[model samples]
Target: MYIIQKLINRFFVKNKLGIFSFTFFIVIFSSVVMQILEPKTFPRWFDALWYVMTTVTTVGYGDFYPVTVAGRMYAIFIFLVGIGIAGLAIGKLVEAMGAHRKRKEEGRLTFKGKNHFVIIGWSEKAKYAINEITETHPNLEVVLIDRLPVTPITHQNVHYIQGDPSIESTLIQANIEEAQSVLVFSDDSIHDSALADGKTLLIVTSVERLTPHIHSTVEIKREEHIKNFRHAKVDEFVLSHETVSRMAVRSAFSKGITGIYTQLLSHKEGENLFEVQKKAEWRTYKDAFDGLLEQGATLIADGNDLSINKKLNEAIPEDARLYIICSKDVYEALA
Candidate 1:
């Protein structure tokens, strides 16, 4: 009952289109019912409906006419009510169509797909992430949600929807439920990192509320908030500042460290981390590493099970299930 009342309020009170539609339906119904009751005195019900339409439109096709006094009175009343209703209906229809077109033009439309990536926020990190994601998953579609306007990317795989990512409406627009994963990035302003973090947390909370099982990664600038974010159950957190500081320290200590790191980060020529399924036919770390080297890709580390067999290197286990660092060409060939 409450829902019905809410709907009535929305249709009759909130939107003029709904009111106009209701009026149009009433006019049509009354004209049909009246004609049916006095069909002998008047023409056919369809003929009467047509007469009402033409009368409202001022077309006045003389083919159908009313002979009885009662029919004429009814026709006069219909002409008056139908003309107003028809005019309002046409106006409302035009308005609704215009709004829909505007939303589409502004890239505020919803999309749904499985295995798609949902990107929340439009910072520089997001740009970098998109570049990396496209190289890795060329066929994967990316859905971006932000408050600002949606800009077109050179890559056809990226899609944009404009809205506050913290809002459920925006997440729905990006099809959060069907997405394989979501990457929430920081806002553009450099000084507003905490503010961005708060916004991101809200978005994370909202996503969890709607879909508790969704996989999500968030960017955190400060180490202090890591615990709080972890408590929120975020799947992954990328410490951008920490990574940059590590690179800076490495560069300071070694002459070619920056260049080597750049190559490692890139997918083209240097070592890039890739996750691949281990077949039952192939077992043991030594065998897998040797096979990957033969395939023109060097094995770095494993991703699945991080625990290492301590004999070779305490940091890296020989029996670990995940491996990192490989060339794109080699990874694709193996895949």
Candidate 2:
């Protein structure tokens, strides 16, 4: 048994397509040999082929059998070789599938998609962002690039590539050029805020260098690293410490503000921020605001500038996009 296993392994290693091709050849050869030896039993080529298949698979029905001595001797040879070849073919196919799965889990597989979200880094914040996006936009495709050995988040729409996010090759594997936006996260495992921010800046710079057109949001642990990211032309920056500190202070001063913010950010409950393109007939901010209100939405901003109550009289640009606070159902209803 050991000798046979070793020989099969050696044969597969020497010839990349050996197992499958050899199995196919054995099936054909056995069929032909059976037709020649059992001419009386199976006069037709199709009947001989059927007999070979059933016998090799160990599903022999009593109807088909080798009546002559020469045919019986050939049948013994066919059973040993044919069954071994079929087993080897099945084992090889299973091994290939397992290898492919391992490569995917290890982030070695290439991603192919457009308008997908590319998340650079693996941390608690990154994991939360992935889950939130997948849950909120179930159809949106997300590719995660990190230096971890395996993917931390498991979702059907999420593809993971395990490598340094700062590396251009890794971003290419994630298909950065086809991505609509990227989110660069700081390494939370790194205790030094400066070092973590430095790593994040490298990833942001790499992303910008590869695809300058794609929008990117970067997370900065220290305020000092903001300038570095700005130089990289990052679309937006999230200061974790600053935001948390302010939220904590605000929560202390006014109770329920934090809970309100959480509810607004969550996709499952309350209304969240959404952006919609301005219509041609909407001449002013007030017109767009009223239109959205009719659809159960409240216009909060015009592009990056907050509209709220100040820009009511301002002329809405034809190409302007309006940010509104609304639920997913409400936003889709307007669509």
Candidate 3:
């Protein structure tokens, strides 16, 4: 026991690889020495290895035992030192696994997933967005970037990166160049609308500089601040304040309007907006509208153009993007 403690204190200070390498050397040496001492007991190298492993682990299945005096002496030597080496190797392996998990939870590891959604900032709104995205597409991955020391949320499909979103290195760590899209949310902690929008603009500028082809959606507190974001070439702007104000006004004037908006925006148990591929047979807007209507789906728009009813005779362009509103099962049936 005393010798075992001393061996641990002296050599266990080495890193994981060192300890494991030494353990492997000791195991090989024991197998070789055992075979040389007692060829009758361990005729093959594999037999010697099995005997050495069983003895060191204390399993001691006595199928093979040394008959000669010299072989027993070497076996005693193995019993004393080999057990401690085996324990040290196992301890180091467990320690390495635990350290790796800690680094991942601290958001100190780089994300390697491609074609994923990268959401910047941590807030209630960001949490809701994460939930909505996961519910809509369970297979897609989402990476969240923020300055918090530790990750705020934990999910199988979501990865967290702790850093300033405006830094190029931080964006690189999140694999922004290969990401499908990026959503930059104004910091909820900043009370000033101009300052919040300014922070969002900085993040968007950094993202666009690193990934010119990536689609970027940004949220701004004030509607007038969108003009400043235009130079950054942001793909979409979400006006937070104006949208809420309009929703509140509509709800006040009309009954049950909020529920309609929620159904259209969410993946919940109601009708929702979905995009479908343009068919080759639909030569005109009228054909698409009539075909989708017969299939129990309302053709709402072609891309952002909602005047399809007035332009029913208009030719459907080659790049036309179609959108529809339908129940979940109805959409699935049509799909």
Candidate 4:
């Protein structure tokens, strides 16, 4: 028993490929031997091959058999060898597939999807961001890249690639060039705020260097890092500490303001902010606002300018992008 276990470990566990190759060779050799030994039963090499395949897989059809004494003895030998080889081959195949899946779950596999969202770094905020995006945009793929060995989020549309997001090769593994957008989260585990922001800046710089036109949003702990990110042409910057502090201050003075902000930010329940392209029919802010209002959407802004108290009669430029507050269903309907 000990000797058998040792052989199994050596050939099946440690050398799976070698055992698979040996099994394949045995199958071919068995087919040829069966053809030569039992010419009467198996008139052609094709018939012998078919019989060998069925017998090895333990799916014997019983359509052919060895009639002569010598053929019968050879048949018994072939049966024993074929069954062992087939069992080992099947076991090894299953083991290999399981290992591959384990590697993938560990975020060691390369992602191949295009037009996907690439999220860099991991934190509670990053996890929430992934949940919101995946929940809101079910069809869009999201790839999470981090230096951690395990995936932070598991979703059908999400793929994990474990690596340093600042590395060019890591970005390539995530297929950053073909990605729709990227979000860089500051490393919260880093004790030093400066170091955390610096890491995020490095990732942002790397992403911009690879794809200048791709939209990118980054989180930074310090306001001083804003200029560095602006130089990188980051589309947006989420100043974590500053933004939360301001929100907290406002919520203290105005009760339920935070609730309103939460509803506007959440994509799951209440209406959320979304941007829609300008249309020809809406020539002015009033025109666009009325059109959106008709569809149950409230126009919030035009480009970076607020539309709340603006002159409605002012002509909206051709390139103006309209931002609106509406439910997901309403936004989809209007869009």
Candidate 5:
């Protein structure tokens, strides 16, 4: 009796798996004992099992009962141990679920997904960028990295990680290697432009070191600092202050110019810009241009070379990434 008590204590008190295993064993053993001791009362093994389950669960349907002295004594023993152990198992399950949620909120989990966009930094601009991405591709996943105590935004496509993004481990946590692209935003809390750009440059350097070929876009507070990031192999840089100043100046010189920039930049409203694949049969810029124009879409640029009119007669290159401006319906049809 002493040895069995010690064994039960070691298994049931210390280990949750052991507790569950012992509970299952006790229930099955109790059912079989009841069937054997009261073959006249409990005619089948299933009937004994049903009675044991109902008693342990405290359901007590009162449809089955023991008619012999030995069966009644066994029932009393099972009633004490089985119900308590079952309750313990249920409590452990709830605790495990809560721990999982806490770990997710604290950003301690690793993302194992691929081809997702990774955004570094937590700011208003980051929020807008994620919202735009989610709105466009509702099913696509976007992983966000920041140092906040908890995730800022909760969406089906958005995942948040709390860590210093410049560190290789944090980037690995975000799964940056398999990511489609990365967007590094300037830290808004820093007051000095140089400091902000410097931090952003460090983050970009870490990104390039880990994934050399991945496309990276960065936000620069000053235009002069753009040269510093060239070695980091950043694919694009959005001059946050300079772009806004230029847009303000353009809006001042021309009426409703801001609206044009807004329409071009945002895809949620108006005829937005979209990238289209150049068809094989379209030999020249003119052929591609005319084909798209007939579909109510205008081919404005072949990549960054927006002067399509000058190059209309030139043969389209095989690697051309043609961009067009058209309504969503027209772009969908062409796509």
Candidate 6:
């Protein structure tokens, strides 16, 4: 035991990789030596060698045999030594595989896809956005990039690459070039929301610099930061605090009323709110409304102004965004 301990300490402690490599070589040598020596007694070199290769790889082809007494004794030793070598080879293989996965996750890898959403920054809000998007558009693939270990979620549709999203190279891993939209969230590590907003602004600016025409949304931790984000030209600003405050106030004043609206916007399985483009082919409001009805969609209203339902005689404004209430499946099919 003491001699084994000393050898292990000398091999593993002093030179870890050298020990692993040496162990591999020793296994190969033992198998080769066993096959060559055993073949002299068995009189089948090629068959014995094939058996050795299969046994060492755990393939167990079972075609070759060691019928002779000497060859059977050799087979016993080969099994013992071959097991050790197989284990070491598997361990090394697993380690290499893990390393490759880490590099791919850390944005040191790149791939391309069409109509993907590149999510920049990692936070609770970022996850919320991912959930929302996935619920609404299950087919839409999401690529998350941030400077932290991105743990996997239940949904395999989402891909995560850990790195600084503000960097151009990191964005490339998320395939920002082919991405249809970008969602920028503030880093939660920053002490202040304004600081987080500043980081988000920087990321947005960088993304805009990289992909000029891509539609991007920036989340604002504070409503006051919205104006500063305007200069960055973000397509949408999600005011986290404002939305929460509105929910709280609504719940305080009227019980269960806010819950209905919340459910519609929550991107859950039930009803969902979506903004559909008003097509010019449909000239009148009634025409568009009837078209949506035929497609199994309920016309909600124009923009956030939900009270005004387009009248039969009412002219459809060219600039108005049509709000439609439908299921995600319906939205995807109708859109």
| Residue 255 lDDT in candidate 6 | 84
The sequence of per-residue lDDT tens digits that candidate 4 reaches over residues 1-335 is 99999987887667988788888888889889888988989899989888888888899899987788877887788788878878888988998899998988898888888999999888888889988887778899999988777887778898989987888999999999999899998888897989988888888999999999899989889999899889989999899999999999999999989988898888765778999988889888899889999999999887778845567889888888779998888888877
List the global CA lDDT of all models: 0.74, 0.86, 0.91, 0.87, 0.91, 0.76
Which parts of model 4 have CA positions greater than 4 angstroms off? 1-51, 59-74, 308-311
Off by over 4 Å in 5: 1-14, 27-55, 59-75
Q: Give the winner by lDDT: 3 or 6.
A: 3
The sequence of per-residue lDDT tens digits that candidate 5 reaches over residues 1-335 is: 99998887788776879878888898899999999999988899999999999999889999999988999998889788889987877777788789988888888889999999999999999999999999888888999999999999988778889999999999999999999999999999999999999999999999999999899999999988888898778999999989999999989999898988888889877989999998987999999999998999999998789899998999998999999999988988987
Cα lDDT of model 3 by residue, 61-147, tens digit: 999989899999999998889998898788888888998888778888999999999999999999999999999999999999999
Candidate 1 lDDT at 63 equals 66
Ranking by TM-score: 3, 5, 2, 4, 6, 1
Ten residues in a row with the worst lDDT in model 2?
A: 7-16
Give the Cα-based TM-score of candidate 3 against the true structure: 0.90
The TM-score values for the models, in the order shown, are 0.63, 0.86, 0.90, 0.83, 0.88, 0.67
For residues 1-335, what per-residue lDDT tens digits would candidate 1 score against the true structure? 99999986777656886777777686678668668756874466777677666777678887666677776777777777767666666767788899986775466777867789988887777888899889867898988777776454546787788887778888888888888899888665756778767777888889877777888898887778888788888888888788799889988888788877777777765677777767554456656666677888666557644443432233333445556457777677888
Q: What is the lDDT for 307 in model 3?
A: 90
Residue-level lDDT for 281 in candidate 4: 93
Steric clash pairs (candidate 6): 146-163
The alpha-carbon deviation from the true structure for residue 142 of candidate 2, after best TM-score superposition, in angstroms, is 2.0
Sort by lDDT, best first: 5, 3, 4, 2, 6, 1
Stretches off by above 4 angstroms in model 3 are 1-12, 32-47, 59-68
RMSD of each: 8.6, 3.3, 3.1, 4.1, 3.1, 6.4
